[model samples]
Target: MASHSFQTVFAVPMTCGGCAKSVSDSLYKLDGINKVEANVKDQVVSVEGTAAPSAIVEAIQATGKDAILRGSGSSDSAAVSILESFFEPDARANQETPDDGVTRDVRGLARMVQVSPTSTLIDLTVHGVAPGSYRATIRQTGDLKDGAASTGGIWSDQGAGDGSGPRGLLGSFTVGPDGRGSAYINNPFQIWEAIGRAMVVSRQDESAGPLKNDPDTVVGVIARSAGVWDNDKSVCSCTGKTLWEERKDEVERGML
Candidate 1:
């Protein structure tokens, strides 16, 4: 059997459990599909099998949602590619890594990272720290990859406590003098909840005013959710460009 793995980002937003289940059910109908996992929270879908990438993309698009494949590899090469992509420049630039050597990056946005079926104990390294608090999240992909029955979770730094929170998807790890540690996401639901909470947190702002049923508030929430934050400057990164500037750039690039 041909095996492949990759990650992608979904243009559409998946808010609730029902929305996730609907997409999962829709993608399970394709041929040559061995397994399908969906992380509604992370807006990712991971697949493994001999299916063509184009076919997988089509199946997802057919469900009225937008999907993009970020990377892919076949057989043994697939595993190497998946691991390397985790530390790529583009991926690293998108996340906030402390100068103190605490780096956290999101892998397989719309796909769940998977290991061999028999493998357990997802090992991870936290480079550059000496016993500090951290949290991690494990996300699974839905039907975006060709259908494959594979699921894997990565270790994250969960502040304090036994790393049990939300859906038991949250985990805590302490780095030794060598700046390395490990954790695991054993249950599927735990992985699901971790991704879900991430989706919600990525779009939420605690500093924002009280939630109301007003349309303006809804719009504000959407804008804030999509907006990026600069920890060093502590301001809205979106403010750097004007609406017309963005539109002009998009038009110039034929994106408009």
Candidate 2:
């Protein structure tokens, strides 16, 4: 593996050694991949490299098998945010909708890993959204009481800004006509500093200043996620569903 490279674990359904071999061989063709280990007995594939986790999952899925990211980096070095729209919270005040339902609110997912003490890698993916450029920023607070508006101003680890500093910008990505977008960003920030903060992905242009009440915006709280070998449950204790079963539901909802 390259210097500062981290390992990522994925749960893939493998029936035999051949299945494992096929998966490993496919991963070896990808750039930045230093090592690939596939275990049929455990139906798990572990990779150590500088490649984006999203790309790793894509390569594994291309092998005719579904792959779910079990973990990444190490304990305390990884985080995740499930970005969802809060456009009509009052209209659906009493309605409960599953993420995979026809009216799913999930718009994107962000996976963050601290590669160095001063740097982090963010693998961001968005689906079922408008086709346009989106700017992502870390908000000062995790409050979502009024959608993105309630999240406050942009967060800057380099001290406060006069409401228009670039330090708070985490960079931007463009969603294609397919209503999907993906970006592997290398930002100068640690994962721990972002925990409990709010992440806003807004369709509004950055030149327009901080987005206030942008209906096309999606918001979510940054939370600590499992690291390599930190998660091992085969089935969700709360949902009573296997890992693959849950993956299927996510894919069906355009989360792939």
**In candidate 2, which residue ranges exceed 4 Å CA deviation?**
1-3, 89-104, 159-166, 206-215, 252-254
Model 2 Cα lDDT, one tens digit per residue, 1-256: 2347899999999999999999999999999999999998888999999998889988998999989899999899999998888776454544554233325377889999988876788888888778888889888899876668788787865733234465558877898998889888877777888999999998876466756654568888999999999999999999999887888787665565
Best by TM-score: 2
Weakest lDDT window of 10 consecutive positions for candidate 2 = 93-102
Tens-digit lDDT track of model 1 for 1-256 = 2243233222223677776676667667766566666777666666654454445666776777655443343222111111101122344334544144433231211222333342212223333333454444332322111111112222233532243543324345554555444333233232212332221101112237421211111110000111011111222367776433544553343220
Q: How much RMSD separates candidate 1 from the native structure?
A: 19.2
Error of 1 at 88 (Å): 34
Model 1: how far residue 18 lies from native, Å: 2.2
Q: For each candidate, what is the lDDT?
A: 0.35, 0.83
Candidate 2, TM-score vs. the true structure?
0.87
